[model samples]
Target: GGISRAGRDALGEATAKILASANTYENQTIFLTGSKAYTLKEITSFISKILGRDIPLRFVSLEEYINQYLNCLDEYWVRLWARTYLALKREELARVYPTLENLLGRKPKSLEQTIKEIFTDKQTGEKESKLTNKYWQASTFDNK
Candidate 1:
């Protein structure tokens, strides 16, 4: 308990120091990504406030086949994330899509749907390689 808090405080101080130094540098780019959308936004805003410039922090969903499959097996995790996607509790379907819910209807039901939702360019649109396909493709963080 104490150790975790200590590590957290140390991290906060280190982050502050980095922010201060980065402002002095004035041209370095910072990327933020995580499951905590709010935390990522906060960190990105903090850096922007320090730098007095707009930082391009993009959000990408974290989608992984093995991870999604494992999570689907966990009933509780499935319910929570499906609700996040507003999914209709389909045990038959392995993964859920928030984008599809946002579509209201006519949801795309394949790798094609997911890709169309991501890339806006109709001409150059293509599915991600099996190795790289995941829920979110924001420029902030890479999956393990």
Candidate 2:
């Protein structure tokens, strides 16, 4: 999976609810999660459908990942990410929790909605947004 994956908007709302009821939710630990956990393959497939462009993917081993990123990222970050990916592969953060929806009293923004927010203007439905362009530019893909 790409991440334990909760939309930022949904997470923010959940945080607000917890803060608002500080007395009730005091000293509590909640694992906020998306409606579902999406794998990287699924996310890229959705992105390709929306953007009408192929986004290539290449899998790498833990050592490969660390070496590939070490130049651009510090050793600390590279090692941290390596560990995180290992945990992800083990499905440590794969569980989806309803605590967010329960607190919000409505369905939280989904991963697809978050993708739309990043790539398109919701109100106008115009061309791809600047953020989308930046995303493409910043992204490093293995086309192999």
- The best candidate by TM-score is 2
User: Where does candidate 1 clash, by residue pair?
Assistant: 60-138, 61-136, 63-134, 63-135
Question: 1-144 in candidate 2: lDDT tens per residue?
Answer: 445487787889889989888999878888898778877777777777778877766676667767887889999987875676666666776788889889888888778778877777778785476454644422223312
How many pairs in model 2 have backbone atoms within 3 A of each other, for residues 3 or more apart or on separate chains, i.e. clashes? 0
| Model 1, position 25: C-alpha lDDT score | 36
Q: Write the per-residue lDDT of candidate 1 for residues 1-144, one digit (tens) a residue.
A: 000011233335445656666765378543211111223345445444433455565533345322544543875674355343222122222323232223223322333232233333345444332324334322332222
Candidate 1 local distance difference test against the native = 0.35
Which TM-score value belongs to model 1? 0.21
What's the TM-score of every candidate structure?
0.21, 0.80
Highest lDDT scorer: 2
Q: How large is the C-alpha RMSD of every model relative to the true structure?
A: 19.7, 4.0
